[model samples]
Target chain A: MFERLLFEAPDFFTYYNVIFLLEAAARTLGMTLIGCTVGFIAGLLIAVLRQSVNPWTLPLRVIAIAYVETFRRIPFLVIIFIVLYAIQPLMENASLLTIATIAICLVSTAFLSEIVRAGLESVPKQQIEGARTLNFGAARTLWYVVLPQAWRVILPPAIAFAVMFIKDTSLASHIGVVELTFSGKMFVNRGFSPLLGFGAVLVLYFLLSYPLSRLGTYLEKRLDPSRRS
Target chain B: MTHLDVRDLACSYGSEKILKGVTLSAEKGEVVSLIGPSGSGKSTLLRALVGLTLPSAGEVRVAGKAVDYSSRKSVRELRSQLAIVFQQYNLFQNMTVMRNVTIAPITIKKRPKAEVEALAAELLARVGMEAKHDAYPEELSGGQQQRVAIARALALQPEILLLDEVTSALDPERVNEVLDTIRRLTDEGITMLLVSHEMSFVREVSTRVVMMDDGKVVETGTPSQIFDSPTHERTRDFVGMILKH
Candidate 1:
């Protein structure tokens, strides 16, 4: 691993290629941003749906549960293949990148929903009563009191899911989206150096996940007033 | 007119009845102390009055208006006029002591921010917690938190305040601080329905004393009438347990 990294060092900062890597990293970041944003919002709605007591909401809840269970149980690559090939006819002229993002978001949303639901449950029942006793109607209670406190608890796990979702963007390379993983694959094929190319992919994945994991830990500690000195 | 009336209130959790046909009343500015052994329905009666728990069969009227559990609006209005302080110090842990006091005023009453803040500061000072304004609930001692809880309850300017053993969770030395605050509120003539085992405080602060056991009010009378003049065997036993302490 060290030998391959040393040999690749001379070519590492070559401007044209560095630009290409930079562009690919940007696309990866974009995928993470778009995917997590859409996924978190959609996941919240689905989680709320799953908890809904209404009879009509039961079928919707079932569909959401089925969606979460289905994607989470299957491999990310398999879901990408199904979305890329089976849904090709539905895309019309839509870009592959957009299609890949949708697939990544759809899958991430399943796991994110469970995290959000658990976060909602972790909030103390007294907090809800505290709001109600203050005459915050149900909507205000949820918006102002419960969700604010729940967000503090939910944030750390949601960040973990975000990092996982970012890493899963690598699977999108199979569909030719030219993300970090795809660029790495192309470099390896051209140079006939699997170790150097994939090593860079490993570094990129670490770079993406490590900061978020650290940030998640930092936030988890910060959000808990009891943990602070 | 009665500021609050609970008529034949009955509440249950699944098969176990927590409150059995409990009837109680409080007039404006009256301090009524409901004393009993543990699990004797005093707390349940207070919770039911605030709609925190729906009674199985009963009526609760606040300031001449009926609280209809079926009507969300009625419950909301009733809740606004009623605030409860718990033995567990149920002030929101995430909020500062001052914010805990100001929450109802700002969020529910829609009072001007300046006015609410001013009143919150005043109430916190009244409870002798003005210095701990910015401190979060976890940072305070149990008695301090209970004082903040009382201030929080008072922020609504409610017609009735239900105190469920507010000092029970405090340390021995801290108990007097909370009790002293309650004593102050009583002196100010706030309408208070207190459930407490602090018989001395009950005798000192309450105009009327109620003895409850096995989910019923065994006796109700002036504190002197009930304390000096015994009525039932159960009441005598309850009085004996507290007086022995």
Candidate 2:
């Protein structure tokens, strides 16, 4: 395996193959980034909706709860297939990558919303009451008091989900999205040694996720209230 | 019109009644203290007054205007006129002492930033927390945080202050620092409704002391009257039990 990998290394390092792999890596990173970014925002909105006790938000809250609960329980791969079939008839020009990304967003939103909900709930009730009694309206209280405190609790897990999600984007390969994993399979199918092909894919995954975990650590320290002067 | 009038204010947690038709009133510039054993609904009354705990039934009027707790506008208006200090300090742990003091005034009230900060600085100094302006709540002692909490409430320039066991969470030695801060405020003429276990301080600063038991006001009198010559058996029993210690 080592000799075969060494022999294939030269062919694998060609400019065209390198660009192909790089593009695949970019797709993976792009999908995760766009999906998780949209997920975080949508998840935060859902979490806040769920937290609200006002009678007016009951329907929205129920819909949000249903979305979070339903999507969270379904397998991501099943969601990808569902999104793929679901989108095909709706739009003629929709790309496989777009469908895969939508699936990623749907699942991540469900998971991340729960993480954010926990983070929001972690803020002591007294803090909220303090804000309420101080005339900090719900939005103001959430912005100034709750979110700032919750970030410390929210960042670690949200970033962890993002990192894990970088790997999970490989599932998109089944839908012909040409992400990192599919790029590896493509190389294997093209007569390259499996070790060289998959090994390169492994390296790209690390390159993508390492910085994210580091970012999580950096954010955890930066946002830590105890660390703040 | 009374500065604060709570008429038959009742509240419940689920089925358990916390404040049962408890009527109380305070005049402008009056320092009224609620003294009671634990679970006597003293804190709940203050909570209800600020609309923190929704009253199951009853009415609260501030300066001749009845507060409609169901209305967001009414609650917001009531909160603008009233500020509360919780027993836990609840000083936004994420912010520095200065931000905690000035945030609501600057952001919520849309007050001028400089003016709010200047008032915050003065209030922090008044609370003896001048040097810790940039310190987070976790960095401060419980008493220090409570002082910051008081300054935070005062920066709003509330017409009435509800102090819910401000010193109850402090250490025995730390209680006086907070008590002294309230001592200075008592004469400054902010109508304050406080619930405290500090009997001596309550007696010393309260213009009138309300004795409560089982979610009801057993008696309302001058501090000396309730402490020395109580009229109700429950008040006497409570005052006797607490004063003995």
Candidate 3:
């Protein structure tokens, strides 16, 4: 296997094959980034909506709770197929990548909203009451007081979820989205050694997630209330 | 008209009533202290006044304008005229002392930044926290945080200040520092409604003292009237118990 890997090293490093792998790696990163970005924003909205005490928001709060609770319990692969068929009927020409990305967004939003909710709740109730007494509206209170305190709690878990999804995006390969893992399968099917093909894929995954985790650590330190002046 | 008028105000947490038809009023520049045992609804009264805890029923009039808790504009109007200092300080942990003091005025009220900052500086100085503007809440001791909380409330330029057990959470030695700050405010002409366990401070600073028990006001009178010459049986018992310790 070592000799075969060594022999294929030159051919595997060919411009076209390298581009193919790089494009696949980009897709994996793109899906994770786009999914988690959409998820975090939507999750934050859902979390905030759920926390509101207004009578009019009750319906929205119920829908948000049902969404997070339901999607979180469903498997990622199952969601992919569900979305694949669901979207195909609505938009007959929808790409596999789009279907897979939608599934990732749905799942990440569910998980991240719970994380954001817990973060928002960690801020003492007195802090919010303090804001209210000072004449702060709901949006101002959140922006000025709650979100600042919540970021410390929300960042660590949010980043962890994003890192986890980097690997989870490989599951998108089942729907023929041609992300990192799918590229490895393609290389192996083309008669390249399995170890070499999969090994490159493994390195690319690590490369994507390591920087993200490091960014998370940096944010956690920067946002620490005790450390800030 | 009373500076702050709470008429038959009632509040509840679920089925448990906290403030049951409690009526109270504070005239302009008057220091009215709510003295009672825990769960007497003193804090809840203050919370309801500021719209923090919605009053299940009753009317709160600030400067002759009735507050409607169900209306956002009315609550906002009420809050703009009143500010509260909590027992735990509740300083924005994420901000510097300066930011906590100036945030509401600068952001919510859209007051000019320079003017608000200048007032904040003066308020912090008055509270003896001038040197700690850059410090965070976690960096301050309990008394210092309470002082900063006072400064934060004052920076709002509120017509009335509600202090809900502001010094109860402090250490014995730290209590005096906060009391001294309130002492300075009593003569500053800001109407204040405070809930405190510090008997001497309450007596010394209050223009009027109200004794409450079981979600009702037992009596309202001057410090000397309530403390030296008791009126109601409940007031006498409460005063007797507190003075004993």
Candidate 4:
């Protein structure tokens, strides 16, 4: 195995094609930003909606639950394929990249909603009463009091999820989004060197992800007042 | 006029009752202190008055206005007339002291920003927390936090104030600072109904003293009468036990 892998003397220097690699990395990062931003906001709405109790809001709650459960159960590959092909014809001049980004965003949103909902539940019950007696009507109470505290608990998990969602952008290749993984594949085909090209891609993924993971840990500790000395 | 009047109030959790047939009243400028052993339904009574816990069969009148808690609009109107402080202080952990006191007036009441901010500053000053307006709740001691909670409640300028075991969570030394602040409120004439375990503070602050047990009011009297004279066997025993140490 070792002989076959290292037998040929190859020019590893030519792989420094800065323009191609930089362009691919930029596209990958851009899609990740779009996916996480849209996904977090949409997911937060769905999570809050799922907890609604009013008669008029009951249908919305049911729809939120169904959306979260359905997206979570189905694989992302299947979701991307469905959006790229099945839903493609219904669109008016939408690009393949747009379809793939939507698929990734939808799946990430389902998982994000569950994380956010748990954070909301972890807030103490006394706070609701505290707001009530202060005459901060129900809607204002939630917007001003409950949600702000919930954000402290929700942020760490959401940051952790954003790191995972950035990785999941690789799966967008099924719909031909030309993200990081697709760039690696193109590099390998053109250079006839799989290990060097793909290995660089793997290292790039780590470089992009490690800082965010560290940031998430640092913030989780900072946000928790009890943990600080 | 009666500032707070509760009639035959009853509340239960699941099949077990927490408050049963409890009725009480306080006139304007009165400070009524509820004192008894733990699990004596003192706090339950205060919570029910604020509609935090719905009464199974009862009515609450705040300053001559009947409160129908079953209707959302009525509950909102009734709440505007009252404010409560809890044993845990229950300050909004995410906000600064200034925001904690000013948020309701600005957001819910839609009062002018300058007006609400001025009132908040005044209330915080009254509670001796003006210097810490920029501080978060976690930065303060338990006693300090409770003081901020009181200021927050007072900022609403409610007709009636409910304080549920406000001193129970503090250290022995810390309790007096909070009691001093409550003493100042007594002079402000906000018509307070408070639950407390400190016998001396209750005797000093309250216009009327109520002893409760098993979710029922066992006795009600002036502080001097309740403390110096024994009206009932239960009241005597409770007052004696708490005053001993």
Candidate 5:
């Protein structure tokens, strides 16, 4: 099954070669890793800031909500274009990898933030009340008592998002990030056995994303209230 | 000074009043039970005292310091002085009974972990939950959860406790264990405001009983006065309604 790409493809060990494809896969994986790691941190900050219900956090809450809504509503492709255009004035020589990374990071931040917010909401109010009566002020209640429970609810969706985000990283190729899709395009330019070669790209994407989704499914069952006991 | 004081406390959600101009006080060692029909604002009064629901008008003084519920710091200070165990028990589902009891003291009071753990063990023993210290809330029956809830509240070393229907959610067979726990707690000299449907238990344990109707305290007296020979017509009707069943 795996022999065809190495032995028979027109582009095999050629201009659009195995080494190039390997390098491209590395770039795409790197972009996804950066996007998800940074996105999760930024998103958690946004989600926590958004849940705060005091005058001090109101402005931050507004900004967090606006970012999530704005990014979630806009198309990812358009986000890359807009980000490229928006940053052109500030950083005139911005690299494609940089633009693609930022765009994906912001997009994932928006989604990941909402996922966390929903998880926070899913935590029953009783849990929070229990904390409050214990004299744990708002922040401690949220961080120590509430969030640990919320994380069980947050994990599956957050991992599922990773699966979608990995496949979505191929969209980076549209802005010339030289990632997986770009590698496939380079091979397509070689013409012979394009079907088989590009089919390998689809398979590669499936291979990368399938494990994440499977893990997420397993986690969802593991987090089931019945299973928790 | 009274351990807990409420002066003309009134709380409402929107335009609808839950507790209306209710005033009460508890001397240390007093177990004052609030008895009334459902929706009589007994729970609301406890909720107000615990800072779970802020009173729209009136003052709640914990150990004589008037609490400013509008201020988070003030409310936290007040909450530290008076712990509440709710009807649902509300033990942290993610935590074991020991963690549930120990977390508040460590987090809110910043007590040394070793000291808090010692107190947690002691409180669990007081509530007869020593064997189940490692158990989670889901593993326990409602009565056992309420006992843990009591221990958790007690671990805060609050001068007063507010119990809102603590035994109402328990099974018939399980209710006695929780009532026995509360009976022991009253002997510890802590002030307590209890809202309970367990009329016989209330009559047996309460130092004083306050009868409420339609969000107002209709009468307040010794348990025998309130139960055996109530003065107010509303109190009589309320007690009669519950006792007949």
Candidate 6:
């Protein structure tokens, strides 16, 4: 398997197994994008709920916190399996892919909520006070002053989460979603070399995640000029 | 009879009291200077006046209206006519100098863009920041940022401006630039309440200087009376210590 990358890539391209795995990687990427968009929106709502100080804020805060803690404590594979098999029976007309997407999205939102909350808290109190003294209302202050600064602080963390979510898309293969990992399994069972099939899947995961990881690093550097030295 | 009056004001956070029974008054267009050692509730007093923190006891009246901390309607009206410039120069780092000055007018005040921009440009020019209208706060020096902060406050056209040690954070050479801008503002007859460590500037520019120690007013008098005629030992000690080279 180690020598395969150096000497066998040209041969692997001719095989049907390699093509099947590539198709699966495309499916995985698609699932990751859909899941991330849904989760990101949900996370934003959760973060806002947790930060709200109104009377209803306490119950929502508790629920939001519990959701994050519970999902984060459970394994990703178990969550996906439960959503695809157990929850699917109750959710009439829901596809396996849809159920898997919802499961991943629910888990991702918890992590994103914490990241965004920390970001929102990092903004200086003086900035908000300065806004108030200038006649800006509460909503205006948060939208114009606090959120911009918060987004800057949260960018790297958000990008890191995106990368993690991409890698975790492999877990969707457990629900018969035919994602990259599932495709690799199919190829291995069809009498192609197991080493090549698994190796290709590992390569696809690395390819999808490495660029995002690098982007996270770049974003961190761009946001903080004091770190240039 | 008074434009602003604070009676028995006490503000607390958690178990600790920050301002204890702070009572004071200022007439319209009067520049009152609050001088004290660090953490003597000078800033806390100013915050209470602006309704940033609701007083645990007593009351604050600006113009004819008492600032209702519980009512959003009253707080909005009071804050609309009041502005604060912090010691740390809290300019919006992401905004240009011109946008920083105009944001309040455009968003909170809901004025036309052409009007706000023109007004912003005039205010920026007043602060000698006409050349850096498009520059962000991070692009400016500390003194320049503070000057922009003053311009931002002025753009709101507040009746009273609270300057919390505006030039204290600047370098020695840059401090004069900010102080000079503030000094020039005195000619406009704008009411100002300054909490500062620059003794000479306060003595020169203040209509009245109120000295505070241990969260209580020690003396309130004209700069001449306070600086030349010592009434209290604490006042004398504060003046003497600050005046000595």
Query: Model 3 off-target regions past 4 Å?
Result: A214-229
Cα lDDT of model 2 by residue, A62-115, tens digit: 999999999988989999999999999998799999899989999999999999
Q: lDDT tens string, model 4, A48-93?
A: 7876667899988888899999999998888988888766688867
Which candidate number would show the highest DockQ if scored against the true structure?
2
Model 4 DockQ, alpha carbons vs. true complex:
0.73
Interface CA RMSD, all predictions: 1.5, 0.8, 0.9, 1.0, 0.9, 1.1
lDDT by residue (B1-245, candidate 2, tens digit) is 69999899899999899888999899999999999889999988888888888999988899989999999899999898998999998888888899999888888889999999999899999999999999988889999999999999899899999999988888999999999999999888899999999999999999999989899998999999999999999998888999899
Alpha carbon lDDT at B194, candidate 5? 94
After superposition, the stretches of candidate 1 with alpha carbons farther than 4 Å from their true spots are A1-13, A48-63, A221-226
Per residue, candidate 5 scores C-alpha lDDT tens digits across A49-134 of: 88777889898888788878999999999999999889878898999899899899999999998888888888889889888878
TM-score for all models, in order of appearance? 0.92, 0.95, 0.95, 0.90, 0.95, 0.94
Off by over 4 Å in 2: A214-229
Task: Flag regions of model 6 displaced more than 4 Å.
Answer: A1-19, A225-229
What is the C-alpha local distance difference test score of each model?
Answer: 0.84, 0.92, 0.92, 0.85, 0.86, 0.85
Candidate 4 regions exceeding 4 Å error are: A1-17
lDDT per residue for candidate 1 within B143-210, as digits (tens), equals 99999998999888977899999888889999999999989888776789999988998999998998
User: Which DockQ-derived CAPRI band holds candidate 3?
Assistant: high
Q: Could you tell me which residue pairs clash in candidate 2? A: none
Residue A15 error for model 6, in Å? 8.3
Tens digit of per-residue lDDT, candidate 3, span A92-145? 888999889999999999999999999999888988888888887789889988
User: How many angstroms is residue B33 displaced in model 4 relative to the true structure, after the best TM-score fit?
Assistant: 1.8
Point out where model 5 deviates above 4 Å: A1-16
Clashing pairs in 1: none
In candidate 6, what are the lDDT values of residues B26-113, reduced to their tens digit?
Answer: 8888899999888889988888777777779988788878888777788888888888898899998768898899998998788998
lDDT of 1 by residue, A1-229 (tens): 6786787777865887778887988899899989888889998888777756667778888888899999889998888888877677986886889889888888878888988898777777878777777787756766776677788778988997888778889888988999999999998887736777777778877887899989999988888634644
